[model samples]
Target chain A: MAVGIKDLAREAGLSVATVSKALNEYADVSEETRQRVREIARLLNYQPNVTARGLQSRRTNMVGLVIPTMEPHLSDDPYFLDLLAGIADEAAEHEFALLLTRCAPGPKERTCYQKIVRGRRVDGLIVVRTRSQDQRVAYLLEEGFPFVTFGRTDQGLDFPFVDVDGTQGVYDATRYLIGLGHRRIGFIAAPEGLMFGFHRQEGFRKAMEEAGLAMEPGLLARGDLTLQSGDVAMGQLLDRDPPPTAVVACNDLMALGAMRAARKRGLWVGRDLAVVGFDDTHVAAHSRPSLTTVSQPIYDIGILLCRMLLQTLQGKPLEVRQILLRPALVIRESSGGTIS
Target chain B: MAVGIKDLAREAGLSVATVSKALNEYADVSEETRQRVREIARLLNYQPNVTARGLQSRRTNMVGLVIPTMEPHLSDDPYFLDLLAGIADEAAEHEFALLLTRCAPGPKERTCYQKIVRGRRVDGLIVVRTRSQDQRVAYLLEEGFPFVTFGRTDQGLDFPFVDVDGTQGVYDATRYLIGLGHRRIGFIAAPEGLMFGFHRQEGFRKAMEEAGLAMEPGLLARGDLTLQSGDVAMGQLLDRDPPPTAVVACNDLMALGAMRAARKRGLWVGRDLAVVGFDDTHVAAHSRPSLTTVSQPIYDIGILLCRMLLQTLQGKPLEVRQILLRPALVIRESSGGTIS
Candidate 1:
């Protein structure tokens, strides 16, 4: 059996009520008595019940992360893994534990949030994959709960967030393709509702307009950010009256899928067609012919988000409530570019 | 302000004590009163404090997973990510939250375990990366805590665990290499203390002894399961008087590292120096000269471990407490083998 406060009281020759007050560091308790009680408790190896103490202090020293597993292939993407590693490492450094809750994207997601928030299971939360008009962000704001997001939501609420400049990243990739003398370029965009989708699409359009290239409706295809979706989208684009000489995908997986589609159609990636991708995941560097991608420091973003959330929890005024990191375009064989 | 039990009591026209009794479903409360209190709570959207409830019930409904971040490059490996996804998905199915705590291996690791276990912060735990005589495992066993390990310990404890047959996996790879007309085979083993290290090394030795092949001590090198370590180990092996033509790495990252080392020496991986890796991770299939590896369903093992732990927590007898999964060898170009 584990030692308890009652045992500490008996060992210290004090009343149970007196020992409790001393252990809890109540102002009514004498400082010398409190110290003596704590010493005896430590020697007895008494572990205070965390839940009971949390009731009194109203602090759990834990942060919650709710992952929406609506996409079946969510785990296959290493982005979340990198983000989780960063958060976990930083949380450990601060002596805080991270509580993870997984739920589907609809009503269940709200219930998952409520359980953690209403129950006060965690002191703060770290939100990811924020969409335009994200209900999760709105709800947290309404409740005045502590949270920091990894992406921006268009709910017009002032909240702390860490995000990559997706428009800049996609714009750079598009300009790089145009610089390679590829006028007819196709785009594989992410599905609707994601904020990055809006930013990245704007970047592509800005780049194309700057080059005075006519927008082709047939050249734009939306993908669910999966390899299969990218392959299907690329195939549709290839079937158009005049196929594009180059393509840019919103993510590395889709870009690899596009490469696979090109290969099936008897086209060599670097020679016959050029491809670019986002999120320079591990597979991007190792894939055959290698993928050129926009690199976002996802792991570091997680660390930063956790730090911000911790600050918010402590009621510290944030020096900067929002951080938008610049994304760099990494040139590789897939982009048909010489590494300068 | 969030609705509390006091609010529910006021709205329901009952005393706080009676409202609490009804909400708690105590036998002393009348059935009608209980129904009335619940209806009022639902109407007011009252969420009970989870910590207080946990203290009363002695159940947190949360499972802890303590990841050892001693290895700096842990996030770079997707194995943990896959495992976490499986566990998180399964945990969500059971309405249990996963609490992640990261700590460097050694005294700090034991402290992490103690905080969660002694504090009763979780209902159960899922231990990973078991060592030959893991102190965590021993401590958990001594405390009679509910836990299921991803790997086995050699402490002779009758505990629940799910492990891949590392010996069989290595034996199969070694035998396959021997069958390929390669007499000199190099082994890149994992560092000492890991339980899998012992089993895998045994498998390599058993296979060599069965084939009447002389084992060269200089051909065997240990790596810390990182890409850089594998590169250094492979470089050392290649400098030997008669370096092995075929190499098998304990993991895909190390195998890729070995391939890089071999390429630096002007040797084609498939044509000149054959390589085999374990844990057919995402990078293994996309890598140039695509890796031939031993495939263990790491994600599925995580799911199974979680299920077993849930059963243990429920005090249900596990149908099969100790599960040893077989690892299959996947043939690819890296092993100089045609896929059959």
Candidate 2:
């Protein structure tokens, strides 16, 4: 038979209540008695029933993370995996297990949130890919659930989140290309529904306007953050009457795709046409000729998100609720150019 | 206040015990009463307390998956992510949430397992990367825990598992290289501790013996299943007195790495040195010259593992206790050769 609190209490010559208190670290138990009870519990290899303890003290010691992706193959996007690694690392360090789930990208996702949070499956949740009017965020807020997000939304709510400065990253990349004597620059942008997508496009527009460059409609193409989409978008730009001398893709996978398109058109990447990508994924570093891109501290953001959630869970006051990290432009062979 | 069983019973004009029986679909409850109870529960937005229900039935409706990797950043391995996607898809489909943990790869891992399985955190577990004489399999077997593995171990114990035929994968890759009239072949192997490592090595040796080709010691190099490791291992092979014209890496990442190494030496892949890899990941298809690899139905195996574990969880009879799926060779430009 599995060892229970009753067995530990019997062995330690203490009441079952006393044994439970000692195990849960209740302040009423004396130190000496607590130590004795713990020793006996360890000797018997007793596993404290988390469920029973949760009933008494409303802490499940679990965190929830729901990925809102219709893509069954989330592996294609390295960004999600990196964020997961960061979250997993911090969750482990803080002694919290991560409960993961995926919701189909549509309206019925609120039911998923209610099932886990209202069902008391997890104490807190981690939300990612925040839309402009994220119902998940609103629901969590109204329900007074402890949660954190990887991106900030335009929902006009105060919440804890860790977001990378995508605007500055794209703006800097465009400025770098402008400084390299590239007046005609093309942008392969992310879908407009995403908050980051809007920020990045705005950054590109601001940079082009500041540099006194003409922002032609043909120079801008839309991509859904996939390699194939990048390829098609880049092709659209190249087919213009005056193709862009330099190109900037929203993410590394798309950036690599742009390079392939340039290569197929017999243009040398560094000399004839320059390319830049965001997110600086591992593949970007290993790509032939290498990709110059903006690097987001993805793993660090994950750790920070988890830490912030833990502080809220522990009822500790946070010094800062909103944490924004800067992304840096990594120079490599793909954007090679001498002084203008 | 959250709706409870008592509230449901009162609203349905039934006793608490009768409501519970109807909700659980007990034989004592009539079909009309069961439907009425369910409709009333839904109307009230009543979420069954999974924890309290689990206390009575000892079923959490959650499965566990722990990745045993020393590398804190598991994003580098696309294979792991694919497996996760597969597991997540099936878990969501079955109305079961997944509990994920990362055991710091060492002796401390056993404590992590005990905490989750023994503490009743999950109903079953899914094990991957089976090692020779795996203590995990042994422990789960001894405890009679409902678990399934992605790979088999050398423990000589009968258990439910969903495994890809790695031996056949490598054997066919080697045979395909041999068919190209390339006798000087190099092999990049995974770490020796993994059961798949042994099986893949045996396949290489058997294929070479059948082809009457010399298995030179200098032509064999070991890698830890990373792109950089593949590059270093491939470099070692190329440093041989007469470098092999054809190379086979245990995985696609390493194969790409080996191709990088060959390219650095000014050798054109598919022309000078043919390369083949296993586990045809997304990158393999997008690589510059494209990679030839053995494709394991990773997503399918993930779904299969969850199905098997669910069967064990529900106490249902399994049609086939042990499932071994075939791995097919996907030919691409990387292994382009006729009479090399």
Model 2: fnat (fraction of native contacts)? 0.55
What clash count goes with each model? 0, 0
Q: Model 1: runs farther than 4 Å from truth?
A: A15-39, A337-340, B15-35, B337-340
Cα lDDT tens digits, model 1, B81-139, are 77887788788789788998777778877767877888898999999988998999999
User: After superposing candidate 2, which stretches have Cα over 4 Å from the reference?
Assistant: A10-14, A22-40, A264-268, A336-340, B1-44, B337-340
Give the TM-score of chain A, superposed on the true chain A, for all candidates in the order listed: 0.92, 0.94
Clashing pairs in 2: none
lDDT of 2 by residue, A125-217 (tens): 999988777788899998898999988898799999888888889999999999888888999999777878777888899999998888999
Tell me the RMSD of model 1 versus the true structure.
Answer: 2.7
The residue-level lDDT of candidate 2 at B196 comes to: 80
